[model samples]
Target chain A: MIGSRQHGGGVIAFTFIIALLLTVIPLPEGLRFLRPDWVGLVLIYWCMALPHRVGVASGWFMGLMVDLLTGTLLGQHALSLTVIAYITLKFHQRLRLVPVWQQSLTVLVLLVLHQLLALWISRIIGRPGVPWYFWMPSVLGMIIWPLVYVTLRGLRRGFRVS
Target chain B: MLVSLSVVLMVMDHRFKSLESVRNTLSLLVYPIQLIVEIPGTVTDWLDESLATRRKLQEEVDSLRTQQFMQQAQMQKFAALQAENIRLRELLDSSFEIGEKVLIAELMSVNLDPYKHQVVINKGELHNVYAGQPLVDADGVMGQIVHAGPYSSTAMLITDTSHAIPVQVNRNGLRTIALGSGTINRLELPYIPNSADIQPGDLLITSGLGGRFPQGYPVATVSAVQHDPGNAFASVVATPLAHLNRSREVLLIWPGHTTDINSVVSAPVEASAEKADTEAAPENGEAADNHSTAADTATATP
Candidate 1:
């Protein structure tokens, strides 16, 4: 049982690393707004699947990584991701009971909340206002939710993460 | 608890600016992930290089040789001009020297935050790259390094909304500040007066007023100038001469360091060729001359 728990921890870490990689990978100028919030999606998935293991602290850690990698205000992404993890943990029981499509709707709200918090921080720090397209990533993250959900679910069952 | 901790971090970072050491330490842990993401790009570049045919390679070499010959010819005239300028400066009893040491750094292909015009370069404190060091491409000034990590650094492109550079008109030497307009292609000159002798197609070069950037490097070309009677200042727009989106390599310059004229004159051609060899040697040639220029537009405008 201890060995299985260790394996599950490794799997979770590997997935987070992959998500971090996808978060910063370069996309074309036109398609940049369409780049999904891969880290946020993965964090939401983990928080919903194993609330005890992946909660606010994991979200905060990943967010700090995003901030360092992206060169934003040090705590900007940390705050957003912590809030996201908290919300996901709060609703994980109800969210897991629903179908994947309905779970995606919840994911959409979480992603939007994440973006809004980030935007608010940017404003407070005197950054210029973004245009309408700045919110496109949340919408794109919503669309990509089902795919991330199924793949992560398969990996979780295979690894027996719980 | 995590939220409050993050909020405290944000306040420290944005308001007090005291968390640089902490950020750098965290960046060290995050560097491996950055390297992993960069592998696919490096692999594609290698594949492209290895797959090139001999004829294609020969053609590239021939073209490069022809370009080098042309540049060498121009360097002769530049050498003569430099001697004359030095002689004139000496006659005027001035001690301003023009040469600076340059190190080539490749832009890591990570696009961080579309809203923030930041690019990562594979040079850092280990390479003697400091915060606020000027970055330039072959064509013109690119930007300045904002955060210097141990193995990599973050640069704010001149097109970022929060960035501004001191510039002067090449034709008449009318000085002004070029502010980034949050777009890649454009820079805004908000301080130019309606009656200022600036026009479309006038070349803007670094005036060296701020002590942050070296003097006389091309910054942008004035693309449009419009006078609004309602406003006191002219709405001047310039297109940055540096290929901000396209250029893969840039030079980190150490201003006031007197390196060999060959490196300075042939910077465009040699930047890519000698990048691998010069990556290790941190050339601390001389102290930077920080004498402020006559106009202080950088502080006034921004």
Candidate 2:
């Protein structure tokens, strides 16, 4: 709790809300599949950065918001985010110690796992997959990970948040 | 625990429609987020419209004036035909059909999943939109509203796998069902017999058999018809006339109660004709059957 002591709940909430908004912003048709899972990425960052403050419940709540926005089967995103948050929290100390590039690799794997879980649920509910490109967001998330990580780290330092 | 709760919700929503109110309440929270996200696009569209060159605007106005004049002339003939139709029905002691009412709605967002052909529209219960209201664009029938919230509603396009529309061939009046093929731009007439009069270029319009959609809107044009000697049912596919992926605006139709429309519309004329028609009961019976069939076609969903 000492490391995250200065991080107000308000800042955490602001980040999550912004991330949710980013997820809903309309993208061009051709680039739709490549739209990164903003909520998933933000949840991962928070769970890894402040494991004690943000964990399974936060992920579950944000996942529900995504479901409401996209009108997918309710609880679909919640289930995936819960599992990812659990995994991230369990490995938070080790994940925090990794180099940025290595962390991106790990984040890529987590995102792919998140998508695979979502894909499996959609398949159960009988939604046909579009194409191989549907998984491209995991790759894009990996590419953007370093930038997000550095910016958030800078924000934390500047605000003296933890 | 949360996972199981969500599963329960999904099953309940799919099977019983118990979560409709829940979804609507949650959508009230979602409405603002949608508006905020749409602001940028709206501003860009506004800028384009306002910043257009005066010459381009003049040309557009001139062309639109000519088009309006032509359409108004055509509409005058249509109105006369409708009045004549009602008068003829009055003479025959049959019912009259009422014209449908429409509300203009703009598309807010398309569902991100390509598998689900659904869009959110700006109109909802506030505008008297309801579930099963048919939607159309400039070209033809687009889809129907599946969920109506307070300020917004969701429409499932004609291309969804679960959607089916009753259609008749314009060339021969052969009736069939056009089932959404889970692909945009195409619908399948799976059960049409090989001997059916359908061809590659035939036009399919709503037969008004389905109680959901009103009669006579163009649904699709037959794009391909493959008949095999060994197969009983021909493989027929048609392209939707509406710009399903492109249209930003849609017309929501209120198909007013069709049953007593004839008596309601011809009340004044009915006074004189009713007395005379009473003398010819057999003619009235035949005319009533024809009128009822027309009424049934407008309301019948199946």
Candidate 3:
């Protein structure tokens, strides 16, 4: 709504669409253990891009979609994602200023928090609790963070085509 | 405004049935994008299979051939014996047994949450897939279909805490319940007596207790039998007979006109009247009995 491009919000929403697509794509059973949190990845990107508008609420909205899409208890992921967004926004200025390595470390902690929140909610709510495999997404998401942040950050910095 | 929209939609789905049609429509809208993301994985799999060495392929072919030969050797006699058994049963006024109609579906991707035991399959409602369908592999029953999508559906594996399968001791036909432990290929058979007639290597099969699954399909093999002197109930642990890890293809079998007791009771008559829309098949004489049971439960539930 500010001096940003006329199409920024539209493009940002489209990216969320792409993230949803990637989230449901079937990975092989073996590789399924390592599937990254596609929604979390994309949400981080957009939250960083347009923090003021696409903050915790956007995360919660996207999180609700994830729950419905995955057929989980609705609001399970929404609450955790919203919490993640809130913390990210609370320190958005600091996160924005850090170097790539420091930023990656910060994202790892964020992913952990997101997952821990989900784990805690599930535990309290009487859902099945598997061992570390539930946290595999955070590990995979962290591994994917650098590549994603680098590529997307490059697009934002270099490719003004959008 | 967008937050309110999402909230309203979420609430519409959570509290009422108004948003299901919308959810289904929105999910279908993403099908093209879903296909695009899924294509790469499929292509990679095809390439991987095509790239398998001829020697390895030949080994597989040889093993399969030898196995088929062994089966054929038994099948010739078994066919004659089966016909005789069927004839003898007909003479006794017993009807022929009903079998499951199976559709082989590929394991798409597992849910991102390790805590939940759910997976998506390539086949969906588009392929006659539906809720209440039993998922299995060559080995045994894995789980049931809890949600059905258009192009892709989700399966909750038996190893989930939310899942429960009725099982029986194959040796003595003693009925028991198998509940999932949320880990891959594990289940807990809780509340059995210390003196229960179970052994470490005993095989468990679908007891058809709940009628959700067909009777007699293998469920699991008891891995541990903990009989404590102090505790009255022995703690039994078993691994699911289905190779939840190794199975590439699984069978999605809904009740196909099964007069199974499970469906008749679990589904309300009001719902069973809607069973044509409910997605389970009725087989056997149970569909006829569905009437009295449905009437009974209608009065039973408060």
Candidate 4:
């Protein structure tokens, strides 16, 4: 039964790679608002879909890679990402039942919280003040949440839910 | 297992600096992946650009043409200024260190996390880009590469909070360290006395005091200087001279000397350009061969 329902690891890893690519590729000036936090969006998708397989622990690991690549203080992204994963896992059942539009709104709030938490940690560690572009990915993440959710749900349904 | 891996990465990232080597290998492998990944976005951008109407396209073309013309005019002025600079370096018998043979590297990928300000470029150990090599645009110094990979490396821009550079006042050559206040387009030159002879418009070029950046490249210009009686030190605000966020191209300047070159050039190079420009990079590299030659021709700060 698990085999019937479970998505292949290759698909998941491929999606992860795509998410990494999305994070790096620059968005155009006009459509930058549509540029989601690719890493978080994918993590949210995977968390809601396969909470047992990947959760806070996995999120923390990936967040470490992001922090390393971005040259931030170690453990900064790990804390926030772990928090995000826990929050998503906590409400995932209800979130899965919610309509697509509301699901996106919920993800928006999570992303905003994630960003604010990172900012708070940054401040505590001696960095002060950030540009408005720092928050752009959150709003963009919200906008793209539906697309990510729908696409993954489609993959899930095409293979198993039916 | 996951937590342990993260702990390992965190430890490696900070304590041992072992991740830098892995990062280099991984980035070199990821280089082609980056190209493949960037293609769709590039195509989408091109398609959107081509979709513009004729009038809008014409307007864009005209504006671009005007911008090009202005840059051309600026380049002419630069040429003339460079000629004068060469003559002055000749007079002072100083070295010429500048744009020629400057390494050019493309931005490979920008770090994705919003909290950190950093970028990785396509240059690396093979290309002579190393940790602490100064990254600059045509205008001024931007940042320094912190982690050098085989084919790519991470550069911490001057706007990043952790990065700082040594700068000198172009007017009188007063030295100070400029700290990045964690914001692009802003840097802080802190700890100067309210009485320091720094004007609002003073240019801050590299002092070469840090043995990191080359001498004479522009760093920042004092945008606003406030000498507060309330605070012990002067509040000097400066904007970085480089338009880094907008620039996709950069030059990596390898200061040819390990010892502070200026801790010599404080002499007549300030008085003349020809003395400075000719003795720039090569002397810094090969001068280790003939130590007395360099010490004699250029004033040995001994």
Candidate 5:
């Protein structure tokens, strides 16, 4: 069990690294709006799968990394990510029991909440007037939740990440 | 607790300099992740270069050679004009401006936030890159460095909404401020008077009033001028000359610090040994010559 836990930790970190890479990778200007929130999706999955291990603190750390990586205001992403993780952890038991599609709907809410928090922060910093397409990533994140869920689940089971 | 901590951090980061050291330290940890993310793009670029046809490569070389020759001819005229300007400036008893020492840095990442126009370049504090340092491309001014990490730096492009540069109309030397309009292609001159001499197609260059960007770099061209008689100011818009979306490499300039020429020439070679391309040497040599000539004029000024 100890060995499996250690292995699980590595897998989780690996996935987070991949998600970070996806978050910052350059895409065509037209498709940028369609790019899913990869880090938030991965964070949600891990929080749901292992709430005790990947909770608010881990989420905050991941947020800080994202802030540093994207060169945004320090703690901007951290605050949003921490809230998302907290919400996921609070309802992880029920979240794990729901069907994948329903979970995706919930994921949509969380992702939107994540974006809303970031938007609120930016507005407070005096950067307002984002376009309507700002909400596209949340919807795209929802659409990709199932794919992320299945793949992470397969990796979890294969690696005995429990 | 995490929320409050984050809020405190944001306040410190945005409102104070207390978090700068913390940010720099954290950015060092974040550097490897950025480098890893850049690998795929770098690999594809390398592949593209290696896979290009012989005929295409020859054609590119031929074109670049012709372009170089034309630039050299222009440089000859520029040298003559600069000499005349120096003599005239000496007669007027004013300090003459020297050529800025420049280091080339490749863009590591593109637009991080859709709302914020920022790019990461491979050069950083290790190469003496600093915040507020001007960035330029082959065509014109691009942006200025905002955060300089150990191995990389983040630059906020001139098109970022919060950015503004002091500019002058190249035609009449009419000084005004150019403000970024949150779009890559557009910049706004919000304070131009309705009866101002500015018109569409007039070129705007940095006025050097703001010490952040050096003078005389092409910034933008007036694309539209709307005279709203009801309003106090005309709504003038311009398209930035720099290829903000396309350029892969940018030059970081040490403005008015010609004394650092030797360090500028040798620093990048020592810092990023892999990037010690042969192209940099000749460019630095040319810049050094310009600096020496300017220095001579500075001393010769009674």
Candidate 6:
């Protein structure tokens, strides 16, 4: 059991890396704005599932990697992710008892907050505001939340990660 | 605490640019992930190229041959015109136009945000690319380099809202600033007086007034001009000549690689500083404006 616990960290790390790659894959021009918030979704899931082991620092690290990969302002995603991770960690116990569909609704709200924070930072830095389509990804993130939660939960149970 | 740190980093990146080297180094570490992410697209592009039919290849070759013949004929005329222009400039005791040196760079990826018209190119600091260096395609001016990583660089297209280029009417030499309107096909010539000599179908060329771009490159064509007596400035719009969204390769101009290009040293610093300043939300435009003007005069004299 202790050995499986030790190996659980590796599984989390591997999944996070895969999420990062998914965030960067080139999308067709017509669907560019619809690209999912893969990294944010993955980090949120890990923070909820393994609150003690994965929290604000890990979220910050993943966000920084996304910022670098996308060539955006260095700490733009990091700051937002840290805040969301902290909020999720604070409520993990209550969140765990919630139903899957309700959990996705909560994720929708969290993703909206994340997008707002990023938008605020970019505006402060003088980037012109984008159109309504900029918010489309957050909606898609909400829809994909259940799939991400189910998959990560399956992996945790299969590995006896706790 | 993390938020404060982020603000500090943002300020440093926007103001001093002290974080550029750090960004470049971290980009090197992150290169493998980017490469992995790009593989599927690259493989598909390669497959498309390899699977092309022989008939298509033959047709393409024939068209290219015709283009080459036409270009050669034009080049013969250009060579004579250039020699005559040099002689006339010498007679007038004016500085000769030095031949520009350029290197080809391939597009790697694009920033997905439609608001920010930026693209990553395969060449970077290793290829002597610097921030604010002018970029062009075969048709016309495209944009300028804004960040040079170790192995890759980012360019801000002229259509980005924050970008502004100094241009003159190719026919009458009336100078004005062409500001990007965040639309791919259009630019705004703000601050043009109502009585300005611009008209539809006029050719706008880089004036070399600001020193970031070389003089006399075709930039755009005036598409509409509206004079409003109610407002102080006229509404002028122009369409960029470059294939901003479609071009696969771009030319990075090494200004004054041949002659004493006076603006080559200070042009990029002032230009990028202006860009960085715009990010800080600062309105201190006088110093950079002065610097560019000084560089412009220096270049004009030789």
Tell me the DockQ of each model, to 2 decimals. Answer: 0.84, 0.42, 0.33, 0.25, 0.70, 0.59
Judge candidate 6 against the unseen true structure and give its global Cα lDDT, from 0 to 1.
Answer: 0.78
The sequence of per-residue lDDT tens digits that candidate 6 reaches over residues B220-297 is 999999998999999999999999988988999976664333233322111122232133322222222211434442
- In the predicted model 1, the residue pairs found to clash are none
lDDT of 2 by residue, B1-302 (tens): 76677678767766666787787778787677777777887999999999999999999999999999999999777766877877886678754345567778999863444457888899988888887788999999999887788998888888887777777798977777788888888998887888878899899987555456676789999999999989999999999999999999899987654343334444434223123223333332223221133233323311
lDDT of 3 by residue, B1-302 (tens): 44454446545554565555555555565456556766777888999899999999999999999999999999787656656655665555533333545678897643444457777778877898766677899999878876677877777888887677767789987666777887786899885788889998999987553446665789899999998989878999998989886787898775534434223222222222222211232322123121123222112111
Worst 10 residues of 4 chain A by lDDT: A26-35
Candidate 3 similarity to native, TM-score:
0.75
Per residue, candidate 4 scores C-alpha lDDT tens digits across B173-210 of: 77677888766789898867788899888999976544
Report the C-alpha lDDT of model 1 over B151-237, residue by residue, as the tens digit: 999998999988888788999877777889999999999987788899999999986665678778999999999999899999999
**Clashing pairs for predicted structure model 6, backbone only:** none
Task: State residue A160's C-alpha deviation in candidate 3, in Å.
Answer: 2.8
Ranking by DockQ: 1, 5, 6, 2, 3, 4
Say which docking band candidate 4 falls in.
Answer: acceptable
As for candidate 5, its clashing pairs are none
TM-score of 4: 0.70
For chain B alone, what TM-score does every candidate structure achieve against the true structure? 0.86, 0.83, 0.74, 0.68, 0.84, 0.85
Model 4 Cα lDDT, one tens digit per residue, A1-162:
777545566676667667767666665544543456677888888898888877897788667655655556566667678878988999989988989889888988999988898788667656667777777878878887888888877875665532
Q: Could you tell me every candidate's TM-score relative to the true structure?
A: 0.90, 0.86, 0.75, 0.70, 0.89, 0.88
lDDT value, candidate 5, whole model: 0.82
Clashes of 6: 0
Better of 1 and 2 by TM-score: 1
Candidate 2, superposed: residue stretches over 4 Å from native: A1-7, B84-98, B109-111, B257-302
Which run of 10 residues does model 1 chain A get worst, by summed lDDT? A1-10
Residue A149 displacement in candidate 2 (angstroms): 2.0
Clashing pairs in 2: B96-B262, B208-B297, B209-B300, B210-B300, B210-B301, B211-B299, B211-B300, B211-B301
lDDT minimum window of 10 residues, candidate 2 chain B: B282-291
The second chain of candidate 4 has a TM-score of: 0.68
